[model samples]
Target: MQRLVKIEMSLFKDILSGISGIFSGSPYRIILSAENKKFYLNAYKGAGAIPFAQLLNKYPQLGDLSVWVNYEKGGTVIPLGNLAYVKKELARLISEEQKNKPEIVIPQEIQQLKPSKMPAGFEIRYSWNDSEKAIQPQLRGEYWGEGTYVSENSYWNMPGFTENDDLWLRKNKIRGQEILEFLRAILPQWQRRSLPVQSEVVLEAEPACTIKINRVRIDSVTCEALWRVNPGSIAEIPSLAGYIIAGSSLGEGFNPAGLPLQTESGQALVEEYIPKTIEKVNEFLLQQHHLGMLDMFQPS
Candidate 1:
């Protein structure tokens, strides 16, 4: 269900409603090694992000978020491909079903559909604030200072909320520290494979396009998939993985992340104006997701 980026109107509304809330929550930072450099991450707004947490307390119905947070429980999933053909195919199926059953029915997924850049699951890297740090010539996770993040993120955590947002990496329900240790165990190897020789990050940015979601099997767990997003260098690079969202049979799987990300707030507002500025509205339509430069990869 490629997170239904070809969206249902109701799902769109649900996603829009959760946008501000994603920004409203507290955020965690990931500091790898002694580098004080910040990572650019488009976690909340990237494809498959679950931005409904802040609203969950109020909207009790929004429960059990998947790796694909933007998707709501009750939306008709439009088939991926030419919209008209999909509709025509659905019509034919419904007609055929009606002939056999004598009951009148229609596609309830009657909502406008449009592609918008959303988020996959966010990667919150954490260590002690006083863990010691260093700085590199270029930004750690940025692509040649381009505003776009290599890996996708939803929203940057706002000021004043950083006091307490740390949670355990809950893979197999182990201590979050253990999860960190697991990444740390592979950190050296992952870094060697992902980072270039001069310790520089290669540029590998993709347009805001949607693709079919890939389901990766992991043992009853949710942990960070420690791989960078650089494409074309895959031959030399070894294994790669991303964020894992477990529990839900439908969306429970790994969402890939290519290592690093850095986000700029003011600029993001300018880029995200339309979707971000949408306040309370009965309905709104999202056309093609035309995110120029600012968008990262399309998550499955």
Candidate 2:
């Protein structure tokens, strides 16, 4: 016999209303690293460390707050007041589940600050696998064919670059480091691959904003399956894996100094395996659908 479960909308709304204030508003962007499975809170310029500590105290499951002290660069900071609001909001949302009652209120100070500016020198690198060449150049001058093309002339492409294909490599450059730092805060159990400890800092007057992206190529089969199922959504699939692989490669499994490898044949093998896995997973999902499992989980 199958058991049926129902979720009430009113309860969900009550819970959302309760917790809406807690997670809302920008308190130093909270990023969750999938591989590390840790939540990181970035503190803006001149921000006190106390607010972050209070945030963790309110929601201990978010892991320790790794304070990234930004100065001169001048980014936004989540003040203590905002943190209190977020805590109150989250408490309201969670309390509706018949859980613990909310014991917090939004502090007046948090409501005072203007929204923080976008953090500079930071860009989110998403994955694409259509082209057979590097969309961006590598730091070591090694050419590895990966990534996709975004044309300036095309409505889809980002501006500035010429209307042609760009190369993307998988390596740790400045942009990659930024991404790494962002991921480290979000994912629990996520670790970076070990690299040789360097004694000196390589400072270039014009720091290259490019990030090498030697991401493990997913099996072509998996890519095809993902494409077949989601079609235009293939970009999303690799991105999920990229975050997982990036953090795991850097922090936890650090012996290789590169992204972790799932198979021996490298990209070719991954391209082959992922499609089948996706197919199987998709089939299972379909079966669940037919069995009314989806309906059972749906909120009423």
Candidate 3:
């Protein structure tokens, strides 16, 4: 009897991947990335047999089946044994997921885009022949958080998104001159609006809400970019957490809580929060270099 042991894995970018092999014959398991675009395996595992004993030693959780390896680039293989053990572990995974289904907070702006009546418990399952089932709901009307569907359609309203800005940038190929031009265009707006002190100012880019350019003075005003967000690139809406540029110097904050803003209706209030967080950093930078500010100031 030949049974295939398949191991599902999760990769960076919220990409779902898997590894499969003949459980008994080969000592090695071949790993594939989620997009199936690339192949990778542990160098040690490829050189020889997978060291179950050594792995069990390093990860004592394997010994008692009480814990599983949960490293950054890590995943668990399907257990080979009695059906009872398999069933029990599956139940435990499900229970854990149910208990800790992280709450998704949609911003008020996005929430308004949802349909008045959402279909309850009616998940649209996809099949090769049932393509029509996919297109019908969107035709009825669009709503935020309605799960995956075919084609590029979003009900959430992102006022900050600039149409084709990324496409233009990519096609033009941003270089030294392009970067300078971008800075120049944004600087005057900063001067007029006092940008770093303002929570949100649109940088001239595709999907404008995702990026911001700030100018703060040390001795003289230095250009600082803040609130860099790219939620649209991900498959899942719930994973849209991003970092803030904090402190007097141009550096990122290490706080795990991340920026406390929700993206709803596809609009993230990073623009709203940018000014609030950057104000203090700008002040600190000014004070730290106030004495020799003019001498150190360099205009770009």
Candidate 4:
């Protein structure tokens, strides 16, 4: 039978080096990092003739010994039935080690925000208004509902609306124009309008809304390159590039009692909340347009 045992080690170089020495002869050794903790393990062959008691005597805190003895190898092996006892000791040792070695904290801007109670699945995204334009300013904000969707074709569909929801249909179309106007305002010098074929459907759910931006396109060209080295290298470049940003929201305030509603098809209320949520996003983009933010692309 072969046994696999894992040991939690301090991140200190000396402690890791000592464990490395103990398992030097093993053909394989793995060091893994997860959840801000480090682990060291060794795999070795075992025979009843070689009892684990001898190993435990040297390292009294061994937590567990996952053993797999091959029955075919003749069950004629010495049985060290104290595997459970070893696991108990190992758990104590790991807890003590974790106490001594705290996790490393990486510094980030999000950490500075006020600790507001956020609903589950909320997220934030950031990017330059014109990703391709070097002089463009970056915009960053929190997205409330379902996170942003990358592809236009992958959005979730609404059930009751079908083709008859006039309010839903009208809001969808107005949202598209709002996005175009937003880009023009942001980049006033960049000559581009909303893609003519773009559309969206904003739907309402109890505590949240869904805004689905569909088939959005923006037309524009690069004003001028931040650099001017070569022309042939920039032939296929677009002067204006459009971004299809999508997201959802749980309205303005956090409503703990307002549980997620269920649709007729049994989908979570968040699903129906997508279209109108995205519509609000387009409205926010329109606000940015009023502020004169424009989308940019390289010239073809």
- lDDT, residue 31, candidate 2: 19
Whole-structure CA lDDT of model 2: 0.27
Residue 234 C-alpha lDDT in model 2: 17
RMSD of 2: 25.3
What does the lDDT read for residue 172 in candidate 1?
Answer: 15
User: What's the TM-score of each model vs. the native?
Assistant: 0.17, 0.15, 0.15, 0.18
Q: Residue 232: error of model 4 in Å?
A: 25
Residue-level lDDT of model 4, residues 76-161, one tens digit each, is 12122222233344335546743222112111111121222223342222122323421221112211112211111111212222
Q: Which digits, one per residue and each the tens of the lDDT, describe model 2 over residues 1-300?
A: 000011123323433454544445333322111011111223221123334445556556433222322122222232322333444444454466433332232222222222232223323332312242111222211111222111111111122322221222233332434444333431111112211111112222221111122333323321111111111211211222222122112221111122122223333324444445434334434633444543322223
lDDT of 1 by residue, 116-205 (tens): 232344223322111111111222222211122222222122212221212211111222234334344433443454322121222233
Task: Order the numbered candidates by TM-score, best leading.
Answer: 4, 1, 3, 2
Candidate 2: where are CA atoms >4 Å away? 1-51, 61-300
lDDT of each: 0.25, 0.27, 0.27, 0.25
Q: Model 4: C-alpha RMSD to truth?
A: 23.7
Question: Which prediction has more favorable TM-score, 1 or 4?
Answer: 4
Ranking, lDDT, top scorer first:
3, 2, 4, 1
The TM-score obtained by model 4 is: 0.18
By how many angstroms RMSD does model 1 differ from the true structure?
29.7
Error of 3 at 48 (Å): 30
